[model samples]
Target chain A: MPNILVVEDSPTMRQLISFAMKRIPNSHVIEATDGVDALKKMSSEKVDLILADINMPVMDGLKLVSLVRGNPTYKEIPIIIITTEGAEEDRKRALSIGANSYLPKPIQTQELIRLVNSYLTKQ
Target chain B: MEKETGYLNKADEFLQMFKKGEEFTKELLKENEKLRYKIAQLEESMERSGDEARTKLYEDRIKLLEDEINSLMERFKQVEEENKDFASKYIEVEEENNNLANLYVASYQLHSTLDFSEVLRIVLEIVINLIGAEKFAILLMDDKTNELVPVASEGMAVSAAPRVKFGQGTIGIVAKEGASYFSDNLSYMKEFNPTTPIVCIPLKIKEHVIGVISIYSLLTQKSGFTNMDYELFNLLAGHAATAIFSSRLYTQSERKLTTIQSFLDILKEKPRR
Candidate 1:
């Protein structure tokens, strides 16, 4: 089964994303309040894919991406940055730091699902 | 005696010649048999070579068929991928259509009631779900006091919401001009400040302004407004104003009827002579 880690500060947004992820066939979703919480969860459970928000309370998503890419242990895991920031610079910076993809909110449910599926099914 | 000796020598020579001719005929028959055996061996080898060539042709045809099958399988996989993409896009479009239908239903439900509190509640619900607002207030204009007072609020205390006079602050200016005010930098607003609302939409019935809807802060995930948000705001500006007005009028009419009934009961009672 694919494990999806959702990192978001807002409870509403977290619930929304988690609900959407559950629609994926045989996907298990893990909720994280922030980047620190996401890292803690990653240490315990095997994370197959990560969908994270950019602006978070403790540690931001960009910092988390850089840390994940720098570490040899978890460098290969695909990370998709979902953010309210739709600027081109934000997308470029996230991809440069090893984010697999960048998706802007007001998220389309089907689009989000399709993007995850692509990453999860990739060899 | 000389004649008889000559005849005997001639007969001996003729017998010798006849014996040599018989030897030559036997050698010729043996050579012809060897040549016939060689021709039979050559014919058998030629037939064997023809069978080998036919086997090689069948092998090449089988290899070509297998290659064609492999290429066909690759094409089938490619077409399946394309179909999946189209299916996903179709689902996305359907989802968007559902959202639009929901908005229309909500708008239709707005005018379905004349209860004052219910209308306000509906407006609040619309803003929360559609606009993604975390903190906001709906302020109505007090006719006698001529100040905007909070009738309903979310994520904040209604009593704490400010009462603004005409042309006093941002909210007041918006009410006076009958135009909506949206902050340029909504992402920077972390806390609720009445003076600088993230957005202030003036509720108007026709050309006359009635009240205002001020959003101090938005949901954390909602960093900025979308086109849908603006469209909803425009909708609330007119529909919300009319709903509130109609409900209030109904309430006042009910109150007047109660007062008149009480007066009629008092008059019907005959005074003690």
Candidate 2:
């Protein structure tokens, strides 16, 4: 079972993601409100993958990426940035900051599941 | 001969006296010439002093004028800078006002369309595009069950069959309160497993709460919700409710008219028979 950390600010969005992730077999989804909360969780638990939103309060997704990458303990964790903005610049920024992948918002469930499965299986 | 000698002596005396007198007059004339020359030099010096004083006064006046001109120029520059700043700010405010006006007009036109579903779809699209929400859903109140049922949705997959109970979930809470509600993280909510930030706004028609509009990130979780997002969602909900209400009224009237016409036709045919 892959342990996944889902960080988002919206309650509806969080529910939707969690609901979609729960469809996948043998996956445990943990939730965080923002980067700060995500970081706190990361420090306490071992997460195989991280699904983060780009825009957030307290700390943003991009900053979370840098924090995760900088920590040797969590450096190898696969991180995906999901955002409403589909611009190339945002994708590039996320990638440059050590994000494993980027997904745009309003994501289809199948696509998200496939991506998470591929990453989990590959690791 | 003695008389002639005496006359000559007298003549000599007169000539000597005359010569002496002439010498004295010449000296007097020389002294007068020197005095006149000194007087002329003194007059020249006075004139020169007067001219120098006049030139100094003119220079002082010019300096004062120059200083005044410089100060005025600096003041003018300051005023110009202030004006430029004010003009730019005014333009920004005007542009914002124009955008708001355009949004209002667009919303009005969208509401005027006869199809309720289309109007709701358009409103959702507009709200999503404006606020950049990842997924959005519109749940209307079921008159019979009094539950919030998902009528239209975008960016998420909602079960069309399951009607969430009023005051059970975030959407229901919003409907129950007849107000807008926001949760940055659903995981914190006891009713819902925290997954992402959510914004839910109630749609009211003539003070009667009818439905709710909710939006959130489907794939990833946002860090937190913003006040601006809440305000924008509230505004969108208000407009959507009005449009929905109007469409419903139009449909009701249309159906009533058709029913009345059919009834009248039947009565007319019977009377003719």
Q: Judged by TM-score, which candidate is best?
A: 2
What is the CA-based DockQ of model 2?
Answer: 0.03
For model 1, the docking class works out as incorrect
Model 1: lDDT of residue B74: 93
lDDT of 1 by residue, B1-273 (tens): 688888888888877877777777777777778888888888888888988898899889999999999999999899899899989987767676545544564577578789898888888867765577878999999989999989999888898689999767999999999999998987757866777898999999998889999999886667788666787799899999999989989988989999999998888885742
- Mind giving the per-residue lDDT tens digits that candidate 2 earns over B1-273? 999999999999999999999999999999999999999999999999999999999999999999999999999999999999999987676545434543554466456587776677666655554355556677788879878887876665766324678887666777888877766464543333222226677888757888877765432334444444455566666777888878867878889999999999999899788
lDDT (Cα, tens digit) per residue for candidate 1, span A1-123 = 999999987554566567678778999999999999999999999999999988888999999999999988889999999876667888999999999999876565567888999999893
Pick the DockQ winner.
1
Whole-model alpha-carbon lDDT for candidate 2: 0.75
What's the DockQ for every one of the candidates?
Answer: 0.06, 0.03
TM-score of chain A of each: 0.97, 0.97
